[model samples]
Target: MNQQRRRQMAENYLVIWVDGNINMANEHCQNTLTQLCGVVNEVNQCTTAEKCIETLQENSEKTSFVISSGALGQHLVPEIHGMPKLDGIYIFCGNKQRHQEWAKNWSKIKGVHTSIKYICEKLAVAIKQCDQDQVTVSIIDINEGDASENLNQLEPSFMHTQIFKEILLDMDHGRQAIKDLVKFCQEKYQGNRKELKFIQEFERTYQSTLVIWWYTRQCFTNKMLNRTL
Candidate 1:
């Protein structure tokens, strides 16, 4: 094959979702089909995300392109867990207005947020990257932080409640919790970047005492526990 032809037939994927192509990875929705590709037999035609995932695991292990088909597009993406084969993500928001109108408070969805952050912090290091100059790797960051950064104007914040003593109490409790957890991790697991990242992600994601306990355990390694805890 000619060089130009080979270049066109490269293994990299450029998945285009149908019906605005928001995100194909959302494991929720009742349709059962969580992925689509230009290929015919690659998609999971099952009735649920669980079944679809099982089918994919049984099928060809080739690089898959998961996209949407525009219909039933106003769906929220699920927090996909244990998807180790996915190489990257490409989101298409063709002239569609964004969704999500939840209150910007931690107390509302701290559990889910904590879970997501824990996954991202672990997977960020494992994410295989492509050189931009050689071939573009389409990565539509699924974080709210990314969306906010795209906006040009800044939203004003209103200072309402005063909780100085509460804040101090929370801090003191948090420090003690961290100390305890770090000591535990050091006693239990190997000291690695993954463990460290897990701790930081947990701390940032959740605010309550339960989250604090989990974060403290994840924060400690050998040297880390010795120095900090």
Candidate 2:
């Protein structure tokens, strides 16, 4: 194959984790994912959150992106023609993380950067139909992360409870080649020994598709909205 053709066949992918509480709307986790996914969706043409991630995987050679939306794209993006293959992930947690002493417990997430109400509204209905225990889906930011002083002191047990990390092996900053997970699972690893020599040539991580929006918000939106964008 020609060099161009060989390059076109290369695969790229992103690994993402969908927290279980987001699906259950616990502690307002659903609300938090909404905004983060919203800005990602604003730029993507994909209809559902799943498709958004699939789009990143399919066109990975050209562009790679990742977003977690409680399997939001299962219905919306998959039905389309160009929808890419998705690497699915789910994250679970016990009711002990954010806040301290009084702030600890199963509280919903707060201060999500975006809004995912449209999708969460639909997921809520699905849970109800299953006849399971009462499920509440909330969106939480959890972005403040686990290392916060509050959670550390109050819920020491919740420390380092990133469950998905057990399965997903991520190297800090462009570790194991871009899209290594996808190629491994799809069995498309080409076994290029030379590429392995230059492993540090590039740093791989979730490149935000929302850069432009965030800048736009900082520039124009802040001016028009009459507040910090």
Tens-place lDDT per residue, model 2, 40-118, is: 2112223345544555655554322223332342232233224333322121223222212222221222112133453
* Candidate 1, residue 67: lDDT: 33
lDDT of 2: 0.31
Error of 2 at 4 (Å): 32
Query: How many pairs of residues collide in model 2?
Result: 26
lDDT of 1 by residue, 79-172 (tens): 2223454343222233222321221121211112212233233222222231122222233344687766533222211111123224323455
In candidate 2, how many Å is residue 117 off? 16
Question: The CA-based lDDT of model 1 is what?
Answer: 0.31
C-alpha lDDT of residue 98 in model 2? 21
